[model samples]
Target: MPIPMNAEPNDGCEGAVKGAGENIVAVSPAALSPDDEVALRRAIGELRRESLAMRLTALIGRQIGFIGLMVPEPIAETINKTAESALRSAMGIALASLGDRSTRDRRGLHKSVATMAGAAGGAFGLAGLPIELPFTTTVMLRSIADIAKSEGEDLSDPDVALACLEVFALGSSGAANPIERGGALEAGYFALRSLLAKSVSQAARHLLDRGLSNQASPLLVRFIAQVSARFGVVVSQKLAAQSVPLIGAASGAAINYAFVDHFQTLARGHFTMRRLERIYGIVMVRAEFERLARQI
Candidate 1:
């Protein structure tokens, strides 16, 4: 999708994204040109579509776990271990990737994610849960960091990097919870919205200036992981999908693709929302988001 270069504050919204927008006291719809209106429509449309997709994947991920349970007890336990290990590895690599942006080939990175996902499936088939998990997790987190960068954040700043990590929580929206009718992902986005850096600026600031690695206190790392677990139900679902024998290398590859792409969309819209909040004020953007979310 073509990203809007100059558009701000009016990107993704819950309700109709036409005719410029409603007039705010500080900014008027009269200022919007025809092109701006079109861009807003496209931007909001993409966010809505991606949000819906994330919900669908979450629902599907939950159901897939039972199928894996059909496997033998011994094998199931092993797969679970693999899944946890994969997540740990992915978490480390993804964080490391954020520290460097000098050598980036997003296209190449996409290929690498696919390749790793495919290889894991082929080598272990349904048994390669450990390998598959890390591939998708790492790739999605990297995509999150990339989205942060596009939203004008410096990944070098620990606060920005922490925000990217929190995108994983967005996945928790429909995990095992009763999705609010049509508002699964939408509701999830709102729930975690407060957890984002803008909403949690004070906490993020402390982590930003402190040494990330050399000075990263155990207290801080533990704090981040604890906050992260608040939305960790979805991670369980993703791991559950590993048990499906029906999805081999090709299946694994497809799942990884969807996983990364879904987060990329989330990160894009999320960062876009933050950018909008900066221009139009947090209260207005959030109110509009909540309103539009109901429609979704």
Candidate 2:
């Protein structure tokens, strides 16, 4: 089916993606050029690759088991703490001085850095995560920022940086369809965005107005907490996979490549959606996004 030109959710366009309990924003569809429609279709494909959990499973060829059995259960707690701290530190120092915002994204360089970090972590098995995870996360944040700029995001804008952090949260889920098997919209892309919208806005506002002097302010803290919760899920999975017998530096490097590649895919899709939203308004673009998602 060809993509819809007019996706009016409230006006009863077919397959309009309404959040389970959220209010739909009322906005008219803009006249999207043919190029814009094609771009929207491609973005939907990338978003559908939301299943990082499955991707890791496929790449490693091993089923990740329960936390306690794979490694010490305390590692789970450590993973969450590490995720939060890494996000905090990355926000403070990662891309602020990237320099030359107009240049093309250096995707290969970022992947190489992540692979090296992963090898270092993999060498010590689970023992290395506390040290390696944060460093690798910071590198992934830089890559995400690079993709955001490639998609035309202004890196100086606090909201865009917050969106960069959002990739971790979004990449943790594995849902392909917005409407799940039992019709729950609990973990879909649009649903997740709806959930995070308030904290994201508040955090962005606080950063824009007061700067990052006090990173522990209520709004920013809440945003980091929320993102860290989801990010911990993926980290846990990666840890479990790493717990597999004989996972040396080589396997670790491969897994890390897949890890960074997964987020890069999500980042590309997300920022592409944002770019289209800037042009056609989110409501129309989102409605059309769901329409295409259903068709696939």
Candidate 3:
């Protein structure tokens, strides 16, 4: 389904808004001249390339960060391999779904794409150092959910997906506008509630174990709580300030984090791989959202 042009922002941010308006005015998807399309395609290609490089860098950074703590090489290796493999598989499935010949065969494929697109959008916004990675990841997921719904998918049953996306949109938007921060916070709190509601009890237990177990060091829990809290604040403020539709950029950021965090946590044994994979299906929906976001 075509992404709604109205969802895009128009406050002179970049060519995305301007181009989107122009395209809307022209009333032709083919209104993009060959030259324009070529340029857009090239830019998108570059963005995709850069996103891949960034993803690799983030992966390596995570590996190195864990290793710096003197983690066992075998455990680190296993974590890195699993995270990389999962990310690659998810991306592959998402891209393929875009071109699936059979519309009927596209349900699962489409969802996967939407999820990843949200992730990619978030990744695009948070590529710099001192990584605000989690915020961007959430935005991506939220964007995916929004996009999927536009395409006629009902995502209400999947609380994890909803929570991740809600937090992302809220956080990213809050970052952009402080007054809106409260909304982002509310959305984030709700998302957390949703995640807990849908989350398997065992998976929650594992997260607590890896994060807050007696055997686990206090430093780890402290770090997780700190980061999570910061994210929560940013997202909540964003949601409070504006409607969800106004926070597309933030939504993209949130989705990106959701996928990355999900995989990383799974690899680190902070969550059950099987349960996480079930949640990972949201990635597909995110990818499609990203594609549509770009078009918009």
Give the alpha carbon lDDT tens digit for every residue of 244-273 in model 2.
777666777777888788788888988888
Q: Candidates 1 and 3: which is better by TM-score?
A: 1
lDDT of each: 0.50, 0.73, 0.30
Q: Candidate 3, residue 143: CA error in Å?
A: 18
lDDT of 1: 0.50
Candidate 1: minimum summed lDDT over ten consecutive residues — where? 14-23
Which ten residues in a row are the worst by lDDT in model 3? Answer: 265-274
Rank the models by TM-score, top first.
2, 1, 3
Which candidate leads in lDDT? 2
lDDT at 158, model 3: 26
Q: Could you give me the TM-score of model 1 versus the true structure?
A: 0.63
- The C-alpha stretches of model 1 lying farther than 4 A from their native spots are 1-62, 65-108, 111-115, 118-132, 175-187, 195-203, 214-219, 227-232, 293-296
Positional deviation of residue 141's Cα in model 2 after best superposition, in angstroms: 0.9
Better of 2 and 3 by TM-score: 2
Q: Which candidate tops TM-score?
A: 2
